[model samples]
Structures are given as C-alpha cells and as structure tokens.
Target: MLQIYNTLSRSKQLFKPIVPGKVKMYVCGMTVYDFCHIGHARVMIVFDMVVRWLRASGYEVIYVRNITDIDDKIINRAIENGEPISALTKRFIDAMHADSDELGLMHPDQEPRATDYIAKMQGMIGKLIENELAYQADDGDVNFAVRLFPNYGSLSGKSLDELNAGERVVISGGKRDPLDFALWKSAKPEEPVDTRWKSPWGEGRPGWHIECSAMSCELLGEHFDIHGGGADLQFPHHENEIAQSEGALYGKDRKLEDAPFVNYWMHNGHIRVNEEKMSKSLGNFFLIRDVLKSFDPEVLRFFMLKAHYRSPINYSDAQLEEARAGLVRLYTALAQVTLSQAVKAELTDLQNPWVMRFTQAMNDDFNTPEAIAVLFDLASEVNRTQGDEKLVLASTLQSLGGVLNFLQRDPTSFLQSGTKDEEGLCPAMIDEQIAARVAAKNAKDFAQADSIRKALLAQGIVLEDKPGGITEWRRA
Candidate 1:
C-alpha cells in the first residue's frame, strides 16, 4: 500500500485510487518559455520516483502532464527571438525532454499541449457563461466571476477578500468584482500580432486557467484521482482550475456527485539554492543541462531524494559533492559482490530479511532517503562479511538496488564513469600508464615504479600488481 500527502484534505491519506488498481495523476508541466531549472528538476524526478514506486507495487498509473506552449511568456519569447511561436516552443520542448530523460524520469502516459485543446476550452467557456459563472466584459474579455463561485478560493486556502486586497491587474470597467480573473483576453487593437481565436464573445486567446481545466477534462475525465503541481501554483492557478472545472462539470442543481473533478491535490515545495531562492531575475538560476555537464545525472536524482519532496531542496556545489561521495560509497560496495550465472541467486530463508526491510521503508511513503540509508547499511554488511556466498550477496544488493533505482548495471561501470576525469584517464588510459610503470620497474628503478604508483593514486586510481608482473587498476 502507498500513502500520499493530499493537499486538498491537508492530511496524509491511504492512496487507494478512486477506481481500484488504477491511478489518474495529473502533474502540472513546464511553461516552455525557458529551460527547466533545478526547481523543475525536483518536481520531475520526485514524481518519477512516485510513479515508479506505484508501478513497481502493481498499480496502473495513467499519468498526464501537460505542456503549456501557448501563453504570454511564449509569445513574448517568440517575438524577442524573431521566430514563430511554434519554433520557440519546439526548441524548448526538445531541451525539456533531453533534461527529463537525463534525469531518468518515466514518460507520462499522456502529454497534452494547451494549443491542441482550444475547442474544448471554448465549449467549457460556453457552459460557464450559460451558468452565469462567467461573462464578457465591455472590453471583450471573458472573466470568471469569482463572486458567483462559493468555493472559489478553497483549494488555495485564500479568501476572495484576500485576493481582492492584493489585486494588481486593471479592474475592467464592467467586471463585477476585483477578484474575477480572465478566462479569455481580447487582442489589443494596437498590438502587432493577433493570436486570438473566434469565441462566441469575440476573437481571443484562451486564458492560462482555462487550458488546464479543459485539457484535464478532455484527457482524463470529469474527475481524476490526483491533481499535482508546485506549491507556488496552489493559490491562483489551481484555485481557478477548481472553480472553472466545477462550474462546467455540473448542472444547475449543483450536486457534488455530478462533477467530482479532483479528489486529491498535491503540491511539492519550492527549491532553494544555498539557502536563497533561485530566480532568473536574481541571476542565481542554473539550467539543468549546465549542472548535468559537471555531475552524473543519477547523482542529481539521488541528491533530489536526499530531502523529502515536500521540503525545499537547497541546490549547491557542496550538496553536489556530498551526493557524489555518497554515490561512490554505494557503487564501491556493489563492485565487491560477484553474481553467478543463475538468474536468482541462492538465498537461505534465514538471510532474506534485509531487502524486505528496505522495501518496507520504501512502501511507507516512497521514503527514498530512508531506503538509501538501508542500502548503505546493507552494503556495509556485505563489505564486512567474509566467507559469504558471493552470488547470494550480489543478489541481496540487487534486491535493494531496484528500490533505490541504483546499482542496476555493473558497479564497475558506475565507478568508472564517475572517476574517469579524476583518474586523468579511463581503463584504456590506465593500461598505457601501467606499461610505462612496468618498464620502469624492469629497469630496476623501483623508485620510478613507486613514483608511477603515487601518480596514479593522486589521480584517484588504484593499481594491483598481479602474477608475472602484470598489473590492473580501478578507481579506489
């Protein structure tokens, strides 16, 4: 069984899908105006782990994450780049996919684009207007009438009064209330490009909130199991989604059963860097690609899991180094165990406890940090033991490995990849150096041989002298 923190209920609930054995989870996706930052990394990998665990435990998850390629930012970016909106959005989506794959995320079952669902959005707008939940203003903008929806601010825990208090946009002449948000915005007469569509009211582009409401309704259903996004979006974007979805999904009678919309809401906390909020305006943001260039992708994934998903992760070079050392420790233990030709290694009934314990920790709440500690403990035991069956030991390590999403390949591969630069070479390069050291020792210059060994060690390489003066080395 799995447990998830449902922000709607403000409690951790036993995650029994509304339809047993199936989960319909919708995670809000990228805006596509820029590269995904480490903040986006937290959300991408955290849910990847969540989806992986649910699938591993025998549940069918239809995960739907949308790509928001149509909006102010995208339009502004296209204009700034002197390219079409299609070109700009496509370039970023490619970058986003590269970053996502590098982090080892499982692809969502459905990835809907906002631009594809304009018709569905128009339909929903028609329903809202008919129900008196929304109306067109004198300026040709259709706005959701916040005063008409009693549950308008429930999801964000903010009241209509609070929203009105901090309102920044121009309160259009005909808008009934200050809290009303735009469902569609008319293209200004003075604007250079007209990106609007022909709605019943006028030609206008769909608002940010309308796209999610319509896309989710069309892709999943009138109701889904979970709606997830960043904590920052909890207030206006999500609250607006609830209002718009609920308004159209039901009839005049307003029975809750008619429009079940979403049962659970989940929000992952923000990511900070070096105890400060990372922002592009602050010039403190790091792109996912830039970070990946220097660090192993799995190291980044492991770093994300170090803190709970609901807590803010502080991104820093120190944290990266710490994650690297932790990875080294894990792969080192895995390298020592040897697997046999048998698919299932020999395990006595008495020694089958550790992997079980690790699974228990993971199932509790996808508690990766705890599961990782369990892994290190198991690795330490395997490293300390003598006369143990190598096959059984390797199998034991493999068992815990899947849960961490680590140690899947040969441990030597991991160690080799990570230490190549530090070693100033790879296996082939080390072999060349070994021949030089051998020639020196052959000349009876033991001092030169010692010098070569010290040089390799300085590069984090360890050499072992073997039978007949042959030598092989691996990273220590």
Candidate 2:
C-alpha cells in the first residue's frame, strides 16, 4: 500500500485510485513562451517520478500533462520576435521536449495542448454560465464569479476575507468582483488575429486557469485521481481550477455535486538559488542547457532526487559537485563487479532487505531522499561482498535504480565521461597525457612520470594505474 501527501487534504493519506487498479492523473504543464528553467524541470521530474512509482506499484497510470500554448506570455513573445504564434510555440515546445529528454523524463501518456482543447474549454465555460457560476462581462470577456462559488477558497485554505484583504484597488478590467477571474478573454485590436477564436462571448481566447480544467476533464474525464503542479500555482491557478471544475454540473445531473473534482492534489516545492527563490527579476535564473554545460544531466537528476519532492531544494555549484561525487561512488561500485543480466528479475523479492527498504521509502509519499540512501547502502554491500554474491548485489542495485530511472548506463562509460569543465583538458588531451605518463613509466623515468600525473590531477582528472599496464581515467 502507498500513501501520498495530498495538498488539498493537508495530510498524507492512503492512495485509493478511483479505479482500483488504474490511475488517471493530470498535471499542469509548461507555458511555452520561453526556455524551461530549473523550476520547470523540478515539476517535470517530480511528477514523472510519481508516475514511475505508481506503475512500479502495479497500477496502470494514464498521465496527462497539458501544455499552455495560448497564454498572454506566448502571444507577447511571438509578437516581440515578429513570428507566428504557432511558430513561436512550436520552437519552445521542441526546446522543452529536448530539455525533458536530456533530464531523462518519460513522455506523458497524453500531452494535450490547450490550443487544441478550445471547444472543450468553451463547453465547460458554457456550463458554468448556465449554472450562474460564470457570466460574460460588459467587456465581452467571460469571468467566473468567485464569490458565488461557496467553496472557492477551500482548495487554497483561504477564507474570502483573507483573500479580500490582499486585493488592491485597481481598474477591475471589466470584472464584477476583484477576485473574479477570466474564463475567456475578449481579444483586443492590438492582439494577433490568430490569437482570437469565434465564441459565444464574441471573439477571444481561453484564460490560463480554465485551460487545465478543460483539458483535464476532456481527456481524463469529469473527475480523476490526481492533479498536480508547482507550489506557486496553488493559489490563483489551481484554486480557480477547483472552482470551475467542481462548480459546473455535468451529464444528466443539472446540479453541482458534493463529490470533489479531484481526489488528490499534489504540489512540489520551489527551487531556490542563493537563499532566495530563483527568478529572472533577481538575475539568478538558469536555463537547463546552461546548467548542463558544467554538469551531467544525470547529476542534475540525482541532485533533485537527493531532496524530498515536497521540500525546497537549493541550487549551487557545491550542491551539484556533491551530487556528482555521490553518483560516481555508485558507478564505481558497479564497475568492480561482473553482473548477470537475470539478477534484476529478483527485485520483487521482499527477502532482500535493500529492496524492502527502498520500496518502503518510495511508498511513503515518494520520499526519494530516503530511497536514494538505500542505493548507497546497497552499493556498500556490493563493495563488501565477493564473487557471485557481489555480482548479485550489484545487479540488484542497478535494478532498484531503474525503478527511479537511474544507473542504467554502463558504469565504466558513465564514470569516465559525462562531466564537463571548460578549463579542464578534453578527453583526447587527457588520454594523450596518460599515454605520455605510461611511456615515461615504461622508460623508468620516474620523475617525468610523476610530473605528468601531477599535471593531469591538477586539471581535475584522476588516474588509476591498473594491472597489465592499463591506465584508467575519470574526471575528478
């Protein structure tokens, strides 16, 4: 049995899928106006880990992560670049996928783009309007009446008074109430022609918050098992999703039901840099490719899983270097043993203490930090054992790592390659230095050999002189 921390309930609860052996989950995905930052990567990796663990736990999971292709940000970026909206969105979408692939993320079972779900959004909006939970404003935009939805602030755990206290006095933007949010926005003259669509509320596009509700309902049905996103979205975005989705009536039932729209809500904490949240305004924003220039993609992945998904993770060079060293130790252990391919099949055996511990850690709210400690333990066991027993333990280590999408590479290759340092020698240059050191040693020029070894070591390369005159090298 597995338990997960449901943000809606504010506590960890036993996971009971709507369908006993099946799970249908929807996660709010990237808004493709720009390159994905570390924050975006965390959401992708966190939910992907959830999906992986659920499937590993013998549940059939239908994972849907929707793309917001028609947001104001996307339109503005396209206009700034003097490109078509489709072209701008496609470019970023490809970049996003490239980033996801580099970070070793699994493709969602269905990635529904918001632009494709316009009609579904309109349909939902229509239902909200009919239920009097929504109305077309004087400006031709349709807005959800937040005050009318009695449970509007429940998802965010804020009372209307508390939410009202934070409201600023500004032009209401044609909203009847300051707290009301747009379900459909009427297009302006300056906006691109393609950005608008013919709808009952005149010509406009769907709002940001409504996109998830429409896509999730249309693809995963009226109600699903899980809905997730970043912690930043918990307030206005996810809270509005709950209002629109739960506030509407569906099927033969013409009244709002008591049943919740989503059974469980999950949110991953933010990524912080230098004791502050990573944001562009602070000038500390990092793009995924930019960070990958210095560290291996797997190292970044390992760094993320080193912290509990619900906890904020700080990003710095020191943290990443520590992650690389930890990953190298695991790979180093694997390199020392010859493993049998069939040994991985024994992962389900509860008799294995390591497997039992790893399973327990993962089952308790996907506590990856604790689960990763089990990997370190297994690696130590592999190092302490010998012959066939060592091989079995090493193989089991690889198998368990696979459940979390780690340690699938050849250990030798992973150890020798992957890390990047601009000031350090390239692979060919390092090999040349090693060959020179080897030649010097063979000629009995001990002083020159020591000098060469020292030079390479200074440049972040470690050399291991092995049996049969073989030299092994890896980045330090």
Return the top candidate by TM-score: 2
lDDT of 1 by residue, 1-476 (tens): 46777777787787778788888889889999899998888888888887877776778999999999888777787778778777888999999999999877778999999989999999999999889899898888899888788776777667777774232234777677877888888886633353567778877788888889999989889888988888877877888898889988663346654645788788887878768877776889889888888888888888888777788888887898798788778777766656544245222232567756666666666777787887788778777875555546656776666655666767767766652124257678777888889899889988998999999898878886767776756665
Q: Which clashing pairs does model 1 show? A: none
Candidate 2 lDDT: 0.87
The TM-scores, one per candidate, come to 0.89, 0.94
Prediction 2 TM-score vs. true? 0.94
User: What tens-digit string does per-residue lDDT give for candidate 2 at 1-476?
Assistant: 69999998899999999989999999999999999999998999899999999998889999999899998888999899989999999999999999999898999999999999999999999989988899888888898888888777777788987875121122356888888888999999999998999998899999888999999989988878999998988888888898899877532232544567899999999899988988877889889988888888889989998999999999998999999999999998888876544368354788988889999999999999999999999999988998888888898899899888889888888887755656667788988988898899889999999999999888778888878889988777
> Residue 50 error for model 1, in Å?
1.2
